[model samples]
Target chain A: MPAVVSLSNVHKSFGALQVLKGVSFDVAAGEVVAVIGASGSGKSTALRCINALETIDSGEIVVCGHKVHDPELDRRALRRDVGIVFQSYNLFPHLTVAQNIMLAPTCVKDMGKAEARRLAEEVLAKVGLAEKADNYPEQLSGGQQQRVAIARSLAMQPKLMLFDEVTSALDPQLTGEVLRVMEDLARGGMSMILVTHEMAFARKVASKVIFMHQGKVWETGPGAMLANPQTKELAEFLSNDL
Target chain B: MSLTPVHIEFIATGALWTVGLSAIAFVGGSILGFALALARISPVPFVRRCAGTYIQIVQGTPLLVTLFLFYFGLAVVGFDSLPAIVAAGLGLVIYSSAFLAEIWRGCLESVPKTQWEAAECLALTRWQRMVRVILPQAMRIATAPTVGFLVQIVKNTSLASVVGFVELAQAGKLVNNTIFEPFTVFIVVAAFYFVICYPLSAWSRSLERKLNAGRR
Candidate 1:
């Protein structure tokens, strides 16, 4: 099957320091792929490059068959197909959860307000916070806000979703709430690329796991690879630093 | 000499003009200043540079100089029949826009980079992202500052007296000249300004407190 997302020799540099040095990976349709790596291993940079948040110095990042390497590429169209959730859950503080979700659909997609609000309500219900739609981001718990962020992306009906260390910013219980929503998305056949430190979730939910170390893919295999990683880097990565 | 009721009414009339002019400047300048702030952040390099130059020129020159330049320049350009109210109104807008543009630009920049990324990921165009995401949040951070700028605008309306506008300060000067009551007339004029500016200042402070209340 053709991959939903593809990256080849993705090199990114911030001044002289290169973060993603020739990183490559492929995410198939409806697949939940976790990219596990240590801090500064370029996992987030790779995710960002896929959405053109950070320009790649040299490489190709194609999301759902659209190449993002060219500066002239229609970013807005590229974005409509690819959704991203951040660790911080960057919801608009001024707007309520429903307004946040309704913004893009009504404004970008040009959907009617009533239709967008209806879709937002449906998605908010799916995320298990339909009643909290009127609450502002600050009024909701961190976990609730993150779920709303996820729902906001889902409301856009993106072809692929990228999660960059989403739960790393949450408390343990809060992390569980977000992970539960992600699992629901996974089961529903949504394509996802997750950058996470939660080994157990990665092991259970991920169809494939790519172990990145020092800006390169150190190993790759099925979810069982987390049980007995081939490389020393993967072993260390899976081992609890505690 | 005992202050006459006529003197009090005279000051009151002038005070009303102060408020009217301030309302004009705040509303007019805010609309123009918002666009100026957007220009400062525009993707086009030349637009950004032009905005930067505008900000510098307005900020570097004194408001007094700008008022003088505009007042005389209008006459020189054959619009000599322009009322002092119109000339001074134009001057205050230019002055207020520069300060407000800088204020709002800071607020806009304070919105997290991740917010922009997330909006882009949602495929919202630049304008959509700004209207939908960035500005909403930025406006939260902007509210107190924008209202606070209103106080400055109100007080600065007094400066219009220099251009022959019969606002409170200039009206006070006229009354004081006849009565030789600089101490009393100027003091009352100052009180009028205080009354107009103090409420706006309080409103701004309350807004700031509300915005920051979520932190704890």
Candidate 2:
């Protein structure tokens, strides 16, 4: 099957600081690719480029058939096919959980209020947040707010999901809940690319693992590859992660 | 020429004109102010500069000078015989819009950067992101200051009297001139100003309290 997400020779920089240099990866349908690296390794930049959130300096990214690098790329359509969750759980504090989820569909898709509300409820239930739909973001715990952020993305029903250190801010117990939701998504055949630090969770849930070092993909293989690091950098990264 | 109940009634009616002028200035200023705020944050350098220049010029000049410029200055330049009310209302709109634009720009910027990123990732159009996400949040931060500004608007209508508009302060001057009772007449006028301004100040304080309640 063709890859749902493909990045070839992706290069990105913020001014003089090159973050991603000639990086490449592919995520086929229903595949879970966990990207693990130290901060500033460009894993997050690579993920952001796939969603066209950060435009690439050079290279090509095609997500769900949209040519993201093309200047004329239809961003709305591309975004509709890709959902992203961030570490900060950037929920709209002024909106209720259900309203936050409903906003995009109702505004962008012209979905009727009743239909969007139903979708909101369905996604909230999916994230185990059905009871918190009417609550504001500030009223919820950090984990709960993060879950609502996940549900907000899920409500869009994208072809692929990008998670950027989504559980990094949560405690261990809270992280477990988020990981379980991701595991459920993977089992339900949703394609996902997650930048994460949870080694055990990555090992268990990631079908493939890409270890990044210094803006390049240093090592990649099945989940078991993490158990036996070939390069010293990978070994050091894995040890530090533990 | 004596201080009579009739003159008090006339001044009270003039207070109505003061309220009307403030409302016109605020509503008109709010619309223009919102546009100016957007221009201030526009991505294009030229548009941003233009808005900045407009703010600087309006803010630098006194409201009295602005009124004179609109009333007498326009007459000097061949648009003769404009009504004093039109000139006064237009001057206040221009004045209030500049200050309001600056006030609202701060409110808009106070919304965190992550909120913009989050909204953009959702694939919302620029207008959608602003109306749905940014502006709603900014409105909360703006409410107290906006109400406080209204009190300024009320007091500033006194300046409109110079252009021959008979608002409260102008009416006070006419009564004082006729009755020769400057102390009594001016005191009553000041009382009228106080009555109009105090509730707005109280409301602004209450809104500030309500907004901060969630933070604590």
Candidate 3:
């Protein structure tokens, strides 16, 4: 199968600060790729570029065959196939979880409310939070809110899911539950590009591991990079965490 | 000179007009303000520029001057038959629309960029994202300030007296001229305004407290 996402020589900058320096990577269908790096290493920017949330200064990014940053590409349509979860969980605080999940499908897809509600139920169940569908985001714990965020994405039936530091905001015990949901998602053959800090979860779930440093791809290898360090940067990164 | 009961009755009626004007201003302003706020954030550069210019023009001018412009200027254009209330209403609508638009724009922009991305990820169109996600959150923060603006509208309606609308302030002026008691009649009129505006100010405070209670 073709790669679900491909980024070639992507360059990005914010004013004087160069956040990404010719970064590039690709994820195959159903593969879980983890990007790890220190703060300000551009891992988050790379994920955002795939969805065209952050515009790139130069280079080509293709997700599900649509060229990101092309301006001519049908961005609204491309976005439908690319789902993202933020570190903040970013649920609409005013909306109930069910409404949050159903909003996009009904409004953008023009689906009927009844059908959308049924789909929301199915997806919420998938995230293991079907019981909390009627509650607001503020009513849920950080982990539960993150699960609802996952369910909201699942409702879109995206071809590729980009997770940016999903568990970085949660406590350890809550972190495990969210990780489990991600693991289950991986097992179910959902292609994902995860920017994460959890070394153990990265080792277990990723088919390919990438380490970034100072706005460049520092290293790329299999999950076995956990045992066999390639660069001094990677060694120092993993050492501090473990 | 002493105040008569008729002067009190006239001032009370004028106070009622002030209330009525405030309601009209709020409803009309909100309808236009929401559009202006949306325009301020529109992806199209020209639309955003036009909206910015409109807000700047309206906010920079005094509402009293606007009332005169609408009242007298329209007469110069051969529509000399328009009622004072209609002219004043139009002017107040324009004035309040700018202020409310700025208030709502601040609230809507306050929503985090992440929420927009989350909506985009779901493939929501621009309108859907705004109506369903952004506005709902914005309205929460917007309620207190929107209500607070109503007090200003009530006070500003006093300016309408210059155009002979005969709302509360106009009524007070008519009574004060006949009664020949400046201090007594005007004080009663001021008291009436305090009565109407004070409660609204207190309610806005209470709402702000409720919204902030969770933070504490």
Please name the candidate that would achieve the greatest TM-score relative to the true structure. Answer: 2
lDDT of 3 by residue, A154-237 (tens): 888999999999999999999998999999999999999999999889899999999999999999998889788889989998
DockQ scores of all models, one per candidate:
0.58, 0.58, 0.55
> lDDT of each model, Cα atoms only?
0.87, 0.91, 0.88
Error of 2 at A78 (Å): 0.4
Q: Write the per-residue lDDT of candidate 2 for residues A1-242, one digit (tens) a residue.
A: 67999999999999999999999989999999999999999999999899888989999998999999999999999989999999999998888889999999998889999999999999999989899888878888888888889899988899999999999999998888888889999999999999999888888989999999999999999889899999999999989877
Runs of candidate 3 with Cα error greater than 4 angstroms are: B1-5, B76-82, B180-187, B198-216
Give me the runs in candidate 2 sitting further than 4 Å from their true place. Answer: B1-3, B178-183, B202-216
Question: What value does the lDDT take at residue B15 in candidate 2?
Answer: 91
Fnat values, one per model, are 0.71, 0.61, 0.69
* lDDT (Cα, tens digit) per residue for candidate 1, span A1-242: 67999889888889989788898889999999999989998888888888888888998888887889987888888888988999999887767789889988988888999999999999999999999988888999899999999999999999999999999888999999999999999999999999999988998999999988888888999899988889887787677542
Clashes of 1: 0
Winner on lDDT between 1 and 3 is: 3
Give the clash total for candidate 3.
Answer: 1
Point out the worst 10-residue segment of candidate 2 chain A by lDDT: A133-142
Q: Write the per-residue lDDT of candidate 2 for residues B21-125, one digit (tens) a residue.
A: 998899999999889999998889999999999999999999999999999999999999579888989999999999999999999999998899899888899
Error of 1 at A123 (Å): 1.9
The whole-model C-alpha lDDT of candidate 3 against the native structure comes to: 0.88
Q: Model 3 chain B, poorest ten-residue lDDT window?
A: B207-216
